[model samples]
Target: MFSGLSAFPLTPLNEKGIDEAVFVRLIERLNAAGVDSVCALGSTGSYAYLTRHERLRVAQLAVQHAGDVPVIAGIGALRTRDVLELAQDAQKAGAGGVLLAPVSYQKLSDDEVFGLFDAVTRSLSVPLCVYDNPATTHFEFSDELHGRIAQLPNVASIKIPGVPADPEAARARVDLLRALIPRHVTIGVSGDAFAATGLNAGCEAWYSVIAGLFPQIALAITRNAQAGNAREATGLSGRLAPLWALFLQYGSLRVIATAAELRGLVATPCLPLPVKSLQGEVRQRLAAILDELELA
Candidate 1:
């Protein structure tokens, strides 16, 4: 379903509300840059932070502007019913597929996790991508559990978050997923820093954050790697080392937004009250990183 660079754009906002124009521009940029797919309301989009109406608007705009690129909508929520509702809205909004992460205040058990997906799959017509993002969800998927979910009807893909700072380990993890999961299902890689390694190791796609802001660079990496120019691809990704280190230190949620803000793609950084943007020292360090990368 999702392959290559599935760009997850940052949800831009102004004091009034979500900046619709900025949202469209971001999606259009990815589409123009030839990203394989667009994932609106993904972790980078702050799906859990936005109301249903806000999330739907982002999905609608993403689908409308994506052109030939498939738009995958993130339908994650704290409860099963809410997730189901959002998934329906996403499909209705013309999203190509829906991504769901098992988010909970209370830790979810393997059976509970399976049941959540089972119920949602029963109600959905479009394919679902199991989002295994432990950083935000706090619930890790054992390979056994992911394999069980893969067997469920309508579950078409699984997103594997990479192990930052360990390229070899990340590739090994990707190898494990390909070995354990069904051959028919797609396995997409997140963690933009290590994703080049994941791609070289045989993952089908890069579900990227930087791709949202810098689709051209992201696409270059994937295209080169897929074309067997892995050394070239790795070298290109190596330029993003400083930024990746920042993401690991503070978090991509912060660093990506800060980068987007500096790039003039958005009027403000990743937003709304309560969500911290960037600070003094950190902002200074980010500036140096951006300058080194020569990103405007």
Candidate 2:
């Protein structure tokens, strides 16, 4: 599993399918910025939005251009069999590991969640990281469930979101996971807003959204926390607060895509139709914010 700044890239897309040229450019930019690892088809990548074949091709594209950097493919799907097939295909495509989250068609029991991961991990030669994103999955894991999952063979990490809305609580939660989970299993803090606090509280990795647009900012925060520079990390996180506010209000996918568009990184604000990217007043606010940060 990825142990440092693992950027969740927004898969640059065209109206019909994946935009190969723009996607390649994004990966090349990430590699040039020296992100520790990149996760293709993550929540930001809109994994569920793509066809199975599109997902496979996206992984192939990412792995081909990853160079020396490790690529972790998101293998989440609504069905167990689909996730399993995706994991196998990811390994075949030379992905370093697979990021699996229990996607629900209906509310899942704890046993059902365990079973889904168990089936996928057992079938994989590569490592598996459990994505513990309750907001999207709507299945919050209990502490006991987390321990049980961590002990699973070839299970390598857990991603926990830490938004600034709940800093002390987020830190306390990270602290508990640090104590409860095995040393071998890394805990990654997602939610770019609260990453600094989570990192200071001892999260081993950051699964970041901001890094998809501004890797240097993301890398600096992680490095600062790793070096015990809490003040510096906190400051960077503060600078990112405006963007995070937009994320909390409008979702990270939309805001990050707007940031990419503002920078001329992608051709158009590409999201699945009906799920619009930022527009009008929000777009103007985002442009102003990015300009203030000198990121536009």
Mark the 10 consecutive residues where model 2 has the least summed lDDT: 161-170
Residue 113, candidate 2: how far off, in angstroms? Answer: 0.2
lDDT of 1: 0.87
What is residue 259's positional error in candidate 2, in angstroms? Answer: 1.2
C-alpha TM-score for every candidate: 0.95, 0.96
Candidate 2 C-alpha lDDT tens digits along 186-276: 8888988878888887788899988877898899999999999988998988987888899989999999988888789887857777777
List, residue by residue over 153-269, the lDDT tens digit for candidate 1: 888888888744466776777777777777878888888888888788777888899988888889999999889888898899998898888888878878888888877878765
Error of 1 at 144 (Å): 0.2
The total of clashing pairs for model 2 equals 0
